[model samples]
Target chain A: MAYLELNNVHKTYIEGEEEILSNINLSIEEGEFVAIVGFTGSGKTTLVNLINGLLEPTRGEVLFKGEPVKGTSHERGVIFQNYSLLPWLTVEQNVLMAVKEAFPKKSKKELTEMVAEYVEMVSLSHAINKRPKELSGGMRQRVAVARALAMKPEMIIMDEPLGALDALTRGNLQDEILNIWGKDKRTALLITNDVDEGIYMADRIIPLRPGPRATLGPEFKIDIERPRDKTEMNDNENYKQTRNAIIEYLMDIGNERKSEAQEELVLPDLAPKDFVNQFK
Target chain B: MKQSVSLNTAGKIARFNIFRFLFQGSIAKVKQMDPKVALKKVAISIASILLFLGLWHMGAKALYNKEADFKINKALEERGQAAADSEAACIASGNPDCQPNTLPSPAQVWASFNSLLKDHGIISADKAAFKEKTAALNAQREAENLDPIVYTGRPSFVDQIWRSLGTVFAGFLLAFFIAVPLGIFIGLSPNLKSAFNWFIQVFKPVSPVVWYLLVFMIVKTVLIGSPDDSSFTISFVSVGLCSMWATLVNTAMGVSSVDNDYINVAKVLKLGTFQKIFKVILPSSLPLIFTGLKITLSVGWMVLIAIELLAQSPGLGTFVWEEFQNGANDSNAKIIVAMFVIGIIGFLLDRIMLAIQNSVSFVKTDAI
Candidate 1:
């Protein structure tokens, strides 16, 4: 069985209404880094929530280790896109909250140390005592990253965690997350809009077509070696080919959507009254 | 050693500078002030207060003269020119009997305030002396399981102030305890909120007098057989019922309007319902809760005097009522003093609540 599997899942917010996600099927093996890249409002978050057991599919099932996914568990840690850190808590406390729940048996000292380690991994040690409001957007996201990682979940699910960050901060965070995942090769899924980010950090990059009923597209395997360098990626032949194919496919679907949306309206033929036509 | 000596001298200079700043109004300190904004603010505040007092004095003088003229004209109409002249002489002589008892001037109000303080001191001394005189007799009565001899004198102005504060605090606590938990429960579910909505709407606008009357009826019946007085209980209960609506409404709104993102975070963490409330909901809703509490305190204070007077309780409300009824030479001035005290105390209560709200809240909540 795959480490995580979605078997022909469909999701709709209301009954008898158009679905948000339809007939979605995907599988990720243990120790795999998978990225699902999509346009904004493509139901990528819905897919991530389904996997994390925050939402149930309208049809079919999501399986984790051959068991059906249920309500949220610490084993599947989610890094939400908006950095859902509690405003009242400091950076260290936010991470500690998750760490304590995930490892209830650990001593207070042990938990503190673990939180410190994760925060240090994200290079936010200097801001450990600061509340979320005091931190910048990028720093808050880093704290969210630390909070998720500190829990030591079996799988990490990120929903555009770096989307709000600037390009430089996004690059740094991508490298940090990749380095952390490299340590244990845990099952990780990243949902992002940035193609370069997906290419750099993920082993297999899949595209989610834009929705009313969004579904996953074919996967592209990155043949690039581990510890890929960004400076040399532009010069690489394989990188160029994969990038072009993905961009072209995305553009084709976008144009297709536009064309589909532009159905001609049948106008009723009518004559203007003599009084109305006088001014014209 | 030289560095340590210099540090000591530096500390001494700082201490002296603080003293000068507080007491002497040192010009050097004023010159050293970088922004000058604070100094300017202080100057403005002093000028405004002086202006207010000046206006008050002028208004009081005008009213006094008007009443004096009316009194003299009446005397002339009743008797003759000699009677009017005697009335004028009486007014000029500052005779307490013939003086106009209209609004008191600022100086008269100040005099009344000092006299109230002196009255408080005399009452304290009298009570102490009575206790000393009855000590032996009280000890004997206590052995026999009887109530001790007690002083039955009227409460001083200071005592009335203390009593009013005590009642307000008691009422505030009652309001908090009853409103917050009920608010939280109602806030948790829309169904409960709807269930309780009609009841809240109906009772929220009821006046303190009606609440007091209702409480009086119930308390009078409840304590019929008991020997203890029920005035405090009735007044405080009425005050609580009168003031609790704002807190209840605010708390419900705060709890219900917590950010969806925080709720989502709580759910993702899989926190238990209890943990979710204390850890997430309560902390997030604290700002609103404090706003409600601040309003409740001020409302409670505003109604407390009226409630106390109605209940015949020994508080500031009753004190003011008695002085008004007494109609003594200094009665108007005493009433004016009470007015100033009430306004100042109300202001202080608000400031205290604001300080507490700011300290606990993540956001700096300004007074509404």
Candidate 2:
């Protein structure tokens, strides 16, 4: 059995009168890095939330390690796009808070050591004592990463965590995350709108089609080596082929949705009238 | 000896180099300093004070001159005639009749001040006499087995000042005690917020005077069951209720305004309610909370004085009232001085609170 399984997951958000997600199904194995790629408002966040037990699926089951997922727990740590580190707490404190909660019985010394280790892992030991406001966007996200990793969850879910960061900072954090994920190969899932980011970071990239009811479209296996360099991967033939394939698929979905919208707007009775009476 | 001499020579050279470096650095720093900015600040301050004093002197001269064009001169003349009449009455009755309605000139008020300070020791003597009278009164009541009226001895300017300050502080403290915790609870819970919000909105708009009257009557009829309640408890309660509304509203808003991201962080970390409130919510909301408190305290002072005036409580407001009623000419000058004193004290209090707020503000993380 897959380590994490979703059985015909369905999420419906009532916006005036519209159902959001019909039936979404996916299976992720332990030590597998999976990225969900979708356009904006493709129910990507809802899917990630369901996977992390932040939001329950309306008509489906999310099984984590053979048990159905319930409400939020420290067992699955999530890194949000906003880098939700407590502004009042120093970076070290933010990390330590999670560590302490995850392992309540651990000694202060042990928790302190764990916090330090993670801070070092993120290469933010220098900024550990700084509050979120004092740090730059990248540093804050690094702190958030440190905080999530400190918990040592069974799986780490990221919801476009680097979307707010600049390109240079995003690339740096991506490598740092990849390095961290490389160590223990823990179950990881990333929800991203960036197609290249998904291909480069995840073992499998799943494209989500947008709609009044959105669902998984196609899974693309990223047949690339581990610790892949961005430049090197871009030059690789397989990488280029996969990137083009995903983009082509997404563009096709976009075009289909656009034409569907046009069809909906079309009024058959409003077509051009015959001008036979004009000559008379 | 030769080695020691060589070492001394090296030390002297090092010291000379250090002195030269220090002198050069000082000269550079001084040269770079903005003397123009300093001079401008000084010039502005001097100009402001000069303008203030100029206005005051002109107003004083106009009042004294009694010119037909100056409307205040007519008022001053009327005041002087009233003072003369009161003085004649006092001489006839062998009692001082200085009061607000019959304001004396600065010269007359200054003379009276000197006489009171040097000859009769009126301020201090009156205070002592009043204290003694209260003590005697309390003793008599104790002996007679009557309800003891706490006679706050005869009021001096200082005594009145202290009494007013005491009431203001006591009322402010009471208000803070009630409002801060309640505000926090309301801020944190949406249900409580909704429940109590209407009540707060209703009460908040009601004026302090209304609160004072309501509380005064309640205390008079309900709590003490007597019109002669001497504890000033009613005054304090009235001030507290009136001032507490602002603090409560502001604090709740402040707490609610705390960044939602902090709350999310707390949730993800699984921090307990207590930890989250104390560590995150309280610190973030502190600037606003302190600002609210500062405003509440100043308003409390104003409300306390008004309450004292209405309640006939022994404070500065009552003193002002009694001086007004006594019909003494010099009393107006005293009132003016008291007004200035109140303003200065209020300004200082705000500055003090601001300093405390800045001290407790969130520490910059980069300082680490």
Candidate 3:
């Protein structure tokens, strides 16, 4: 049986309205890293929320480990895009809250050590006592990552976690996340808009065609070896072909949608008013 | 020995650091402030206050002269020129009976303030003496399970101020306890909020006097057989009910408007209902809650005087009422003194609440 599966999932916020997601089907085997790349506002977040059990599918079934998903559980840890660290709590406290909740049987000392370890892993040990307001955007996102990872969930779900960070910070965090995921080889789902980010981190990349009834497209398999170096990938054959193919496909669909939306306006055969002639 | 000495020195340094930390923020702020701007602000405030006092003095003098003239003219009309002259002479002589019983001048109010302080001192001495005199009798009364002989003297102005403070604090506590939990419950669901909306709106604007009467009716009957006084209870409860509406409304709004992101985080963490409220909802809404509390406290203080007067509680309200009824030579000045005390206390209460709010809230907020 697949580790996590979504079968014919359909969702709409309002009853009898245009569906935000329709006829969605996905299945991830254990220890598989899957990335879903899509444009902004393409219902990517709604898809992530459904898989994580934050939202229920309006139509179909989402099964996890051979059982149907019910509500949210700590097993599917989500690193939210907006760095939803509780503003009132310090970084350590924020991580500690999640760790304690996920591992209720763990001792306080154990939880504290786990929080410290994850914070250090994200290179934010110095900011352990700082509140979210006191941290930079990149630092806040790092804290969110630490909070999600410290719970030691079976799956790591990221929703464009580095979207708000600058290029340099984003690069550093991508490697850090890759390193962490490689250590455990946990089942991971990364929802992002960056095509290169999907190719680098995900074993298989899929595009979510743009919505109001968005569905998944054909998958691209990345047969590249583990620990893929960014610089060397430029000279590699598979990387060039994959990057070109994904970009071209995205552009083609994007242009197709644009043309479909642009209906040529036809004006009626009309002339200027004859008021001047009438007055003369 | 070296380690022990270092530890001792470290402890001493830590003690000094405590004081340093307490004042460091304000000292830094002052140091960072531009000297010229700070001076200008101080100068403006002083000038405005002086101008207010000058206007007040002029108004008082004009009213005094008008009353004096009217009195002399009435004497002349009733009697003759000699009587008018005598009346003018009496007014010029600065007799207490001939003084205008109108708004007291700032100087008169200041004098009244000092006189009240002096009266408090005398009353303290008298109470001490009374305590000494009744010590043995009180012991016997205690043994016999009888009420001891108490001081029959009136409460001093300071005592009345303390009484008012106590009542207002009690009222504030009542308001907080009643409003916060009820607000949270109402805030959690839209249906509850809608159900309670009309009820809150109706009661919010009801006058303090009416609230006092309502409370009095209920409390009087409930405490009919009890030995303890119910007036204090009625007064505080009335003030609480009268002032709690702002807090209730603000709290509901705060809770309902918590950021969706935080709520999602709570859900993702699988937080229980109470856990979600405490860990996510309360912290996110704390800024608004504090804003509500600040309004509630100020409103409670504003209505307390009226409630206390109606309840006949021994507070500044009753003192003002009594001084007005007394109509003695210094009665008007004493009343004015009470007015200033009430205003100053209300201002201080707001500042204190603001300080507390600033400390507790994650975000900065302002209150006046």
User: What is each predicted model's overall lDDT from 0 to 1?
Assistant: 0.91, 0.80, 0.90
Off by over 4 Å in 2: A13-16, A260-280, B1-35, B63-153, B221-231, B363-368
Query: What's the number of clashes in each of the models?
Result: 0, 7, 0
- TM-scores for all candidates: the values are 0.91, 0.79, 0.92
Q: Write model 1 residue lDDT over B1-368, tens digit each, in one string.
A: 99999999999999886554333323444566765776796799899999999999999999999999999999999998999999999999998999998999999999999999999999999999999999999999999999998999988999999999999999999999999999999989999999999999999999999999999999999899998889999999999989999999999999999998788788777888998899899999998898899899999999998999999988999989999999999999999999999998998788777767766788875543
Write candidate 3's Cα lDDT for A131-173 as tens digits.
9999999999999989998888899999999888888999998
Q: Pairs clashing in candidate 3? A: none
Tens-digit lDDT track of model 2 for B1-368: 99999999999999986555434533454467798966776799899978876677667766544432243334447777676555445444634442223334455555655643453356576656776878878798899999776434455666677888888888888999999999999988899999999999999878878998788677776765455565488788888889888789888988888887676667667778898888789988887788689888888887766788887878878877777777565666666656666777777566555555555676411110
Interface RMSD of each: 1.0, 1.9, 0.6
Q: Write the per-residue lDDT of candidate 1 for residues A1-280, one digit (tens) a residue.
A: 8999999999999999999999999999999999999999999999999999889999999999999999898889889999999999999889988887788899999999999899999999999999999999989998998888888889999999999999998888888899999999889999999999999999999999998899999999988998899989989999999999888888988999888877766578876799678988
TM-score of chain B of 3: 0.91
Winner on lDDT between 1 and 3 is: 1
In candidate 3, which residue ranges exceed 4 Å CA deviation?
A: A264-280, B1-28, B366-368
**C-alpha RMSD (angstroms) for model 2:** 10.5
lDDT tens digits, residue span A121-142, model 2:
9998888788889899999889
